[model samples]
Every structure is written in C-alpha cells, then in structure tokens.
Target chain A: MALLEARAELDVIVWPEDRACERSWLMENVVGATGVIVMFPEKVNTELLDKAGPSLKVVSTVSVGYEHIDLKAAAQHNLKVGYTPDVLTDAVADLSVMLALMAGRNGGIGVDLVQKGQWPNFSWSPFALCGPQLSTTAASQTRKIGFLGFGRIAQATLARLVPFGITHCLYSSNPSSPPNYARDAALAKQHNLRAVSKVDIDELARESDVLFVLAPGGSGTYHVVNEAVLKKMKRTSILVNASRGTLVDSDALAKALREGWIWGAGLDVVEGEPNVTIDHPLVKEPRCVILPHIGSATLETRGEMTTRAAQNVIAAILGEEMPSQVDLSTVL
Target chain B: MALLEARAELDVIVWPEDRACERSWLMENVVGATGVIVMFPEKVNTELLDKAGPSLKVVSTVSVGYEHIDLKAAAQHNLKVGYTPDVLTDAVADLSVMLALMAGRNGGIGVDLVQKGQWPNFSWSPFALCGPQLSTTAASQTRKIGFLGFGRIAQATLARLVPFGITHCLYSSNPSSPPNYARDAALAKQHNLRAVSKVDIDELARESDVLFVLAPGGSGTYHVVNEAVLKKMKRTSILVNASRGTLVDSDALAKALREGWIWGAGLDVVEGEPNVTIDHPLVKEPRCVILPHIGSATLETRGEMTTRAAQNVIAAILGEEMPSQVDLSTVL
Candidate 1:
C-alpha cells in the first residue's frame, strides 16, 4: 500500500471482496489500465488482453503456476508477465512433506474416525490403523524417497527428509537432461544418503516407500502416473501429489487405492479441484487425503507472493525490469 | 504363528478372533493359566492376580506403557511382568512429527473442509487458509522445537526435526536430574543446531514454536500443560501430544483453542480415551486434530511389540530371564 501511495497520481482498483474478482468485472475495469495484478483464478487470456487494449503493459500473478495464464496470448500482445516463483517454494515444499506424512501415517482417517464418534468403539489392536512409518528406526534400516520431478520444491522436500534417516533419493525428471554425477555425489554426501541418482519411472515407483509427484502441469505430463505406473509402486508405498493434479489419473489412483495396489495418497491438487465434492472418487477412498489447492497457503508465503506481484506490476509500468519475469518465448 | 507352533507342547489358549478378546472369556479362561499376555486395555491388578492364583508366573503386555499394570500388586503376587519398549519408539516418534506438521499446517481442517464439499463455496483468497510453515523456509530462518520430556521418543522426534532446519532445541525433564551439557552439546554439533539445552517449563512454553508432549503418563505429569502454560505460548505456536492424553487438560485446551490462545493442537491420545465422543471438548474445536490413541499403530512396530511380549512370556515360563523384565522395585 505504501509503494502505491507514494505515487499519488496513480489510480488503483481492487476487487471489493476477499474472493477472486468476477470475470465480467475484471474485463470491464481492466480497460485503460496500465498494469494489472491477479492470481491463479483470474485468467489472463486473449479476451482479457483485448479488453485491456494497448494500455495493459503487464500482467503479474501472485502464484507460481501460469498454466491458468495463456502465455501465447500475452506473447501476441507483446505483454510482459511476472510471477511469484521461488518466494513460495518453502511453503509448497513444506506442504508436500506434510501431505507425505499425512498419507503415510493415515492422519486423515485418524481424524475422521475421532470426529465421527467412532473412536470409543475402536479397540487397541496390534496392527489396527497401522500405516508406514516415515522415519528409519531399528526395524527399518533404510528409508528411500522418490520424486516424479526433481525441481526446486522436490529438492526442498528432500532436504527436509534428510534427518529422518533417508538413505536413498530417486527422481525421474526430463531424461534428455545430462547426468551430473558430481552434483548427485555432493548431495548424497551432504545428506549422508547412500545414493542420490535419477531413475526411470518404473524404478522410481518400485523403490520409493513414499513417492511425491512434483512435476509441472501440461498436456505432455498429463496422467504421467497412470494405472501402469501405479501398479509398479510398492503396495506399502504412499503417493503424494503436491503439484498439479493432472499429472496423476484420479480414477486410476482411486482404483489403485481401493484394490490395495498402493497403500495411500495425499493430494493438494485434484484433477477437477475446487469442484471436488464429498462423492469425488479420490475423496471417497478411505486411504486418500485430499486438500483444496492449498500448497502455497501460508501467511508468510502468500504475503510475499502478493508483494512480489505488486512489485512486478509497478516495475513493468515504469519500464523497469521485473524481479521474476516469465520468459514468454520459452513458455509459449 | 510359527514361533507359537513350536511351543505347542505347552498348553496355550489363543483368542479366536482378530478383535479384542472378550473380557468375560479372558477372566474365566485365565484360571489355572501359567502366563498371560495382554495389551493396554487389560488391567493386571489385585483382582486379576488373585484370579490367576499361584499358577500365574508372568504377565506381559504388548505395549511400552505399563500404567494399566499395577506393579505393586504384581510384586506382592511374586509375578514377573514384561512390557514392550524400544520397538515402538520409531513409530511413535514418526507420528509425533506427523501430528506436529498436521497441526502447524492445518491439515485436519483442510481435509475436513474439502470432504464437506465446502471448497467450491470458499474463495481463493491470498490468506484464506494460511497457517504456520513447519520447515525453516525463506520466510522463517530459525525453527525452535521444544519437548516436555527428553526421553527416547522425544530424542527420536528431535532427530527427525533436524532436517527441517531446526535451530534450537529445548526440553524439560525431571528437575532432579542433572544437566548433561556435554551430551547436549554433542547433539547440537551433530545436528548443526545453534543450541540444545534443558529449560524450565515456563521457558519451554514461552519459546517453543512447536511444543511436543512426550512425557510418560501418570498423576505426576497429568495436566502439566494447563491454562497457564497455554497462555504463555505464542499464538502461532503448535502443540502436539503423542504421549498420554492426561498430559494436557482437555477442557483448558478446548477453551484455549476456542478463544485463540494458541494456533492449534494435534493429539494422538486423549484423557479418558476410547471414550472420546463427537461432543468431546477437544474434538469440537476445529483447530484441534484428535486421533484415537494410535501412537504405536504401525505394522512393523506393533508386530515387533507383540513378538517381544510373547518372548517375555515364553522366557519367564521356561525359568529364564525375561527379555524385557519390568523392575518391580523401581516401578512400584
């Protein structure tokens, strides 16, 4: 607010409510605007750009994911785009680990059982309500963690898993990328992990006691974790999707969970999320824990993202370089 | 099953079902029995000992907690008792961290809201569901983890927190126990923690960003985390109880949560548990995530505990030292 207040001549309009702005209101108000800031829900498409006409110099979003924003449209209009990326890495990574733990430990089931007043009827059995342990102990000598995509959030999550006696780290990323033995060796030594190496999807599924899907969302990566991929995962393994939901087939995962192909799942993003109902296949599964796209919902991270988005708009309007500008050429 | 099969020469009665053994049947069938192995629910008191008569040589429980066993009565009856320990440490410790993360990140509320079909009604606001991040991210540099007791489970939990960039560790144990600076310093150095020191209850309450109660259950520690301590804690702090439910006063905690004295709590055990209902004070709080007592409810841990318990029974019956004999003098 102070930054905007400094320029008294500038006019600003914000959505009146805490909710995402209505599409019609945004299109109407965006006209004659020099800059606009939005979030995941507000689509920056050709229609919005055309509505803004030539006055809109930039569109900055308070989110890391830009699949909602049509970069091809922005490119056609020769518009600069800014996104908050690394600022929310820690928050998303933390939520990733939280999901992993929740899935592995059956946290959702535990809470639900208690909430329904069924706890009093449950008996203390030797193996009842049991799930996989996330840490290495006397019974388990080694713990292995796998990532579908070895990106910033995945690595951050790996860093958090080191002290849990994680012995191996397996990741399946872009196979075309060259192997870097030196980097892998350094990471292994730093975390005292026995090995840190890239693996194929099959091996990643077979070995990971907990597999985290942290890949980007796109048609190319859609359903990367389908029935075939899930079948290879250890029956004791847990699957966590803290990234885009499209990377995993919800129907396949729900079937896998029901048939005991995989032990459980924790998902932040679902295929048709924000519209997921109580009867959703994944939500109906006893072992699957679902959250409504809250991977970056932390006070500190959200505030930082908002600040960064505002800064990007202010910079773009003044013809200054954005701190975290999205390269349209690559995105397009 | 194989282990017990080998000892078929000895008369043994097995519970026919996977569920808890019928109480009336146990009391009647235990007559003239040389040994008995039970779990948390069975009370090994004066009545049980009297019923077993002089034939009962040992009573073994498939749990680390012996609060249900009356050691004084067992001593009078000249019966050796065994309790499983160490086997479930890793499982409980893992759950402790899981609870802490769930409480800090609002996992329970997030899942519940999604399951209730409320997400579509909710808006995507910057700070709608924001809570504290468990890991030391760009927004948070130092994470302080506190423990009510510095015993095995607490230390195991501390080990897990190290990878999450925990900077400080504070614990409060029996005041009579002398501080072991050398051991604490070594732990600090090993985990790259800034400091690891024992503190008073007041300091623990005031300083911890996440407070875990891993102390043993009994009258001495009952309600240790009362209203005063809750008031001293930071509003953003999280409280986790993986030990015993009695450690926290449920009514006080309910009021604290309702009035926003602290952020939230994750409880695996509750006072008068197995009796917790939907209208229970703690369960009624949205911020409090309650689980039926399931700290050691892992397949590996529970199986190990049962095997250990059986071994104790077999050894005691064979005129050999028990594998995990409880020192009656100390316990009494």
Candidate 2:
C-alpha cells in the first residue's frame, strides 16, 4: 500500500479488490497507467497492452514464476517485465525437501491415521508406516538423488542433500546448455558429493532414488514427468514437485502411486490449483502429500518478494534499470 | 526371520504372538531360555530374570533404547545387556529433519486443510498457513540451531542442518563431561559452523531458533524440556523430539503450542505413545505435528536392528563378545 501512496505523484490507480484483481477492472484501469504491479492471477496479454495506450512502461509481478505473464505480448510492446526470483529460492527449496521427506516417509498418511482417531485400533508392528529411508545408513546400498531442472532451486536442494550422504546426483537442464562435466565435477567437489552430472530424462528417471521437479512452468516443461517418465522411475523412488504443478502430470502421478510405480509423491502445487478440491485425484491419493500451492508462502520470502516488486515498478516508472528484469529475448 | 533360522543348533524359543508379547506369556516362556531377544514392550526385571533361573546369561533387545530394561535389576543379576545402536541412527535422523520441516512449514495443518476441504473456503492470502521456515534464507537473521543432548542422532541432525545455512550451534551434554574448548573449536571449523560450544540448558533453550530434543530418556531427562524451557524459546522457534517421548512433557508442550510459547513442534515420539490417541491434547493442537513412535521404522533399518539383536544373542550364548553390548559396568 506504501507503493500506491508513493505513486501519488503520478496518476496511479490501484485495484481495490480483496480477492484477486478483477479482469474488467484491470482492463479499464490499464487505459492510462504508467506502472502496474500484479501477482500470479493477472495475465499481461496483448489486449491489456493495447488498452494501456502506450502509457504502460512496466509490469512487475510479486512472484517467482512468470509463466502466467504473456512474454511475447510484453516483448512486442517493448515493456520491461520484472518478477521476484532469488528472494524466494530458500523458502521454496525448504518446502521442496519437506515434501520429499513427507512423501518418502508416509508423513501424510501417518498424520491422517493419528488425526482420524485410528491409532489405537492396532498395536505397534515392525513394518507399520515404514517406507524408504531418505538418509544414508550403514545398511544402505545406494543413495542416488535426481532433479528435473538443475537451476538455482535444484542446486540449493542438492546442497541440503549432501550431508545426508547422497552419493550420485543426476539432473536434466534446458536443451540449450550442453553437459559441462568439468564444471559439474567442480561443483561435486565443492559440495563433497560423489558425482554430479547432467543426464537424459530416461536415465534420470531410472536412477533417481528421489526425483525432484524444479523446472519452470509453460509449454516447454508441461507434463514433463508424465506416464513414460513415471514408469521408468524406481518403485522405491519418491517424486516431489515444488516448482510448478504443470511440470508434473497429476493424473499420471496418482496412477503411478496407486499402482506402485513409485513409492509416493509430495506435491506443493497441482495443475489448476486453488480449484483442486478435496475430490481431486492427487488429493485423494493416500501417498500423495499435497499442499495448497504455498512453495514461497513464508512470511520473510513473501515480504521480500512484494518489496522487490514495488521497487521494480518504481524503478521502471523513473526510467531506471529494473531490479530483476526478465530476459524476454530468450523467453519469447 | 533369516537370522532366527540361522541359529539351527540353539534352543531359541521365539515369541509366536503377533501382538506385543504379554507379560504373562513372556514370564512363562523364559523358564528355560539361556538368552532372550526382546523389543520395547518386554521388561527385563527381577521376576523374568528369576524365572529364567541361572540359564539367562543375556537379554538382547531389538531396539536402540533400553529404557524398558530395568538396568539395576539386570546389573544386580550380573546379566549382560545388548542392544541395537548405530544401525538405526540414519532412520531416526531422517525422521528428525522431516519433523523439523513439517513443524516449521505447517505441513500438518496444510495437509489437513486439503483433507478437510477447508482450502476452498478462503482465497490464498500472503501469509496463509505460513510458519517459520526451517532453512536460513538470504534475508534470515542469525540462525541458531540447538540440541538438548549432543549424541549421535543429534550430531547427524546437525549435519543435515549445515547446508540450511545454520550460523550458530549450541548443545548441552551430560553435566559430568567437562567442556573442551579446543575440540569444540575444531568441530566448529570442520562443519563451517559460525560457533559450536557446549552450553547450559537455559542458554540452549533461549538461543535456538529450532531446538531438537535428542537426550536419553530417564528420570534425569524426563520433563527436561518442561514449561520453563519452553517459555524461554523464541516465539519463532520450533521444537523437534525424535529421541524420546519422555524427554518432553506432553502437557507442557500442548500448552506451549496452544498459548504460542514457541512457534510449533514436530514430535515423532510422545509420552505414553501408541496410547497418544486422537483426543490427546498434543494431537489436538494445530501447531503440534505428531507421529506414532516410528523413528526407526524404515524397513532396512529395522531389518539391520533385528539382525544385530540376534547376533548379540548368539554371541552372548556362545560366551563371545557381543556386537553392541551395553556397558553394564557404568549402568549398574
């Protein structure tokens, strides 16, 4: 709200909705705004850009993922787009590991058993609630960790995995960057890892004891961990998606869990989330630990994200370099 | 089962009951056995040891903790006690970190929000269900991690915390051991810790952003983390108990969680567990994430523990050195 107060020098209009900003209100308001700040719900498309009438210089979003933003439209209008990124990396990575452990260790089902008042029905058994151990032990044979996209979030996650005695690391990045074995070996040494290397999707699926989905959302990465990839995964493996819901096909994951293709899944996001109700397939799966799309819901992370977004909008309006301007050339 | 089968020549009378071996049944069966392989439920006392007459040389338990074994009685009878130790360390450590993340990130409440269908009732607000993050972010203040007792499990848990950007470390061991500044300094440097030192219970309680209770269970440790210690904890701190239920006072913890003495608690073990039913005060607390006593429930860990117990029994029966024999000289 301070950002809105700061914009009183310029004729600035703020969306007055308690919920997500209304499409019609955004459309009408864009007619004369020099700067606009939004979140995940708003879509910056050509129609909105056209309505701005050349007055709009910047669109700042208070979120890390910008798949909802129409990059092509922003590029066409020569608009500087800014989104919060690194501020949220730690919070998201923390949640990602939480999901991995929850799924692998039967956290959701165990809690449900306690919450539903069914714990006293039986005595403690040796194998009750037992699942694959996440940490390496004296008895452990292999400890392999994998990632769908080896970016900042994935690397942060890998750093967490090092002290757990994770031996091998495998990941797949975007097709543009070729494998750099030397660089990866250096990274491995830095983290005291056995090995860290790029691998193809199939190898990543088959070898990973725990596979994390940390890719961006959009057509390029949508449903990347679908039926085929799910099938290739070890039966003891766990799938965690803290990146975006679109990266993992929920239906495929549900079926895989039910059929024992993988041991379990921990998901923070679902495709078309908020709309994903109690009746959703992933929600109903006993093994799937589903959160309500709160990967960066930490107070510190959210506060930083909002402050950065406001600053980016302020900078863009003042004809200064935006703090975190999205590179539209590669994205579009 | 294979371990039991391996002892073809010994007159090993295995407990045939699927449930916890009844006290009456155990008393009847120990009449002629030279050794007994028991679990947490069985009490090794004067009565059972008396029943076994002079034949009982050893009581091997398939658990890491021997709280159930009446140490005084065993020591009085000159009985050798063997327990499975190091094998289950990783399993417990894995669960400890899981509980820390779960409590700090509101994994329990988030899962319930989905299962209870309350997610659709409200819009995604900026701070909905957000608790203190487990990992130290770039914006994080001094991240202090504390341990009530610095044992193997606690040290293993600390290793997991290293990559989470933990800055300070504090721990309290048994009062008898003198603090070695030089050794502590070396350890601090080895783990890249900002500081690591043995502190008193009061300082440990007050300083830790995330406090872990990994002390042994006994009268000395019972209610060690009581209301006073809970009160000293930071309002944003989290308490994790992966060691013993008795180490934490359940009533005090439930009160702390309700009154917001600290942020939240992740408890894998609770006082009078298995009996910690649906209506238990700790279970009912929204901030308390409770799990049944399954800290060492991983299939691999459990198998190794059982094998070790059997091996201890075999070693004791043959008058050989036990694999993980308890130092009864000190216990007595």
Worst 10 residues of 1 chain A by lDDT: A1-10
- Which one is best on DockQ? 1
DockQ, every prediction: 0.72, 0.63
Question: Can you write out model 2's per-residue Cα lDDT over A244-264, one digit (the tens) per residue?
Answer: 888888889989998999999
Worst 10 residues of 1 chain B by lDDT: B1-10
Kindly list the interface RMSD, in angstroms, of each predicted candidate in the order they appear: 1.4, 1.7
Candidate 2 segments exceeding 4 Å error: A1-19, A22-31, A46-53, A330-332, B16-19, B330-332
True contacts kept of 1: 0.74
Per-residue lDDT of candidate 1, residues B147-254 (tens digit): 999999999999988877789999999888999999999999988899999999999999999999999999889899999999999999999999998999999999
C-alpha lDDT of all candidate models, in order:
0.89, 0.87
TM-score of each: 0.97, 0.95
Pairs with backbone N, CA or C atoms under 3 Å apart (clashes), candidate 1: none
TM-score of chain B of 2: 0.96
